[model samples]
Target: MRRGCPVVAEPLDTQSLDAAGPAPPISEADRSPARAPFDDLASDWRLRHLLDVDTLSRDEILRILSTANAMAEVLERPVARTPALRGVTVFNLFYEASTRTRSSFELAGKILGADVINVSGSGSSVEKGESLVETLNTLAAVGADAVVMRHPASGAPWLAARTIGGHIINAGDGQHAHPTQALLDAYILLREFGDLGGRRIVIVGDILHSRVARSNIWSLTKLGAEVTVVAPRPLLPVSMTAGAAEKEHPLSLPNVRVESDLDEAIVGADAVMALRIQGERLSGKLLPSSAEYARRYQLTAERVAQAAPHAIVMHPGPMNEGVEIAVDVAHSPESRIEAQVSAGLAVRMAVLFLLIRGGA
Candidate 1:
């Protein structure tokens, strides 16, 4: 884990398993056209904070997707380094633990030649009675250009954004949102099917507490994908109607459907995204047992076969192998779990590039 200056007091021992290491050198073949597909959107994107996908416009979403596509091309080169954010400093201030997201952001910043720092609540002033606002202000005071943060509290990123002047990238904040994860998932699907318009995507497993599902619903719907969320009644939100008066419920976006029958949801689907059960966040009343959950909602090879012949499988990962997805299905040729991870790197790189340099 890369350490940064402590928030207020002494630094804590915040070593992470997903530390960013040295990237390979960029080769001549890695160079591509300098122009970005979403240059217009980039210029128009005045917001310095990336709080959620629900607030992003279709053109803005496409701009990030196009920028990610460009970054993917760079990754294929011998040297993947870019000086897009060479002098910028980025900090990962995670109040909650994450393997894929934290590592992805750290690596993205490093590959773009930015100074990346990792600060965790466990070993920082946050553990010593400091407030979130205080820590964010301290980071800004120390010259941070951007802050990628994850917190167990919902809307924590939004709160931080209101307190700080630097760019705020929400890694994950409770069940409210995981915007970048959604963008990368869309990137993978777009690469697979070329177009998302009119395609069906089934998101299975725990829905009530999944930040990934919330973000995916917003982004995928904007891209014109037909989204169906399948889960046991306990795991599904109480309401699925868009623009509901309740603010705490899961979003009811247009073109989205809620189903309890996992089998019924997968039929004719172009892609299936199996979300983890999120056992840690559960209240113990929503589920019976892991065995039962697996029997009812697990994405087995047989269930996958019920979908379109060319349908693909997806999982945001740290997969609860047998609980929500069968092991064979997760490792199947149609599975895009690994591809999502790769896409995350490029997507995050694009996000940092756009926020720091303002465009390609």
Candidate 2:
């Protein structure tokens, strides 16, 4: 049976459902022009590559979100395919294993009529001793118009953008940034709460190793959201704290505050995002027993009630049910987790359309 979200039991599991869930039927309102202030169909998109959320300004971020709204309308249509990216050759170069991200990117590209090619590290020349630099250069040499890459290293996309001729979209780069995930997350919130300014957003979980948390910090703070990052002392990175210097943690803006108490931080939150525990990235025991961690951090139904009455629960999946988030909470009416995946498709389609065809 097709589930609502493609979230699997683990992030490394390659057998998850396709991230593009069934599209909602189009409505009369969906056919209308986007209501965002900026014109999403404009031909003035300037960024060549989406390497990080830090590179995007408030206006640019809004533009992308607005464009995604238009893309959503397309998704609801009888025939969801669009010719916006026709003749474009897009390459998904994933060094790390992924299910949601990889599947969504591929679906997004195909839906936009791009010639999508997927290349995994193990399946590609990287397994046969090809260097990252060589692999990136090779994709460029083969006429890739845009390359979506997920790597184990933090600044791999930046390196690829420098080395390759095509555009570099950071799928997820180690503990650095997952820009698109942040965008889709923001999209979900924007749809729920029109204005993010002065909104309280609580992020709970393994903050130290989560690229999702890092990316969310940049995007949410930029949009004037009051972001509270809650985690255990070990799981919380010193770089993301307010006490850290600007030069030390440039992306950790003034709107963000660190908290050790999930319940305390979640109070009056407009949204609560529980990040996945990045087990593969952990080394030398950053966490205690999983049971202990769950007791301290799991987003349960009771804790969800502590937030604002309309507060939405979010997760950048493959979720560890009963670990980072409780099973019922993941499927709760207030949970926007499934919608986040759907929004990812539209957001990615917008990204590719704007980058390749320069919008509608």
Pairs in steric clash, model 1:
12-123, 25-79, 26-79, 242-252
Summarize candidate 2's per-residue lDDT along 1-360 as a digit string, tens digits.
121221211111212112223233445453444432122364687788898899998777876766676676666667877666767899999988899999999999998778999999987799999999998888888899999999999998888988877888999999889999999998787767666778999999888888998889989987878888888878777665557642232343677777788878888899999988866533347775778878888999999999999999999999999889999999999998888888899888878877765521
Q: Tell me how far candidate 2 lies from the true structure as C-alpha RMSD in angstroms.
A: 8.2
Q: Give the runs in model 2 whose Cα sits over 4 Å from its true position.
A: 1-40, 240-252, 280-284
For each of the candidates, give the backbone clash count. 4, 0
> Per-residue CA lDDT of candidate 1, range 1-360, in tens?
111100111001111101222222334444334643333325654657788988888767766766665566556657767666777899999998889999999999998789999999998999999999999999999999899999999989989988978889999999889999998888777766656779999998888888899999999998889888888877777665345532223453678888888888899999999998877534478887888888889999999999999999999989988888999999999998887887888889878878766721
Residue-pair clashes, model 2:
0
Q: Candidate 1: TM-score?
A: 0.85
TM-score of every candidate relative to the true structure: 0.85, 0.85
Query: What local lDDT does model 1 show for residue 276?
Result: 89
Relative to the true structure, how large is the alpha-carbon lDDT of every model?
0.79, 0.79
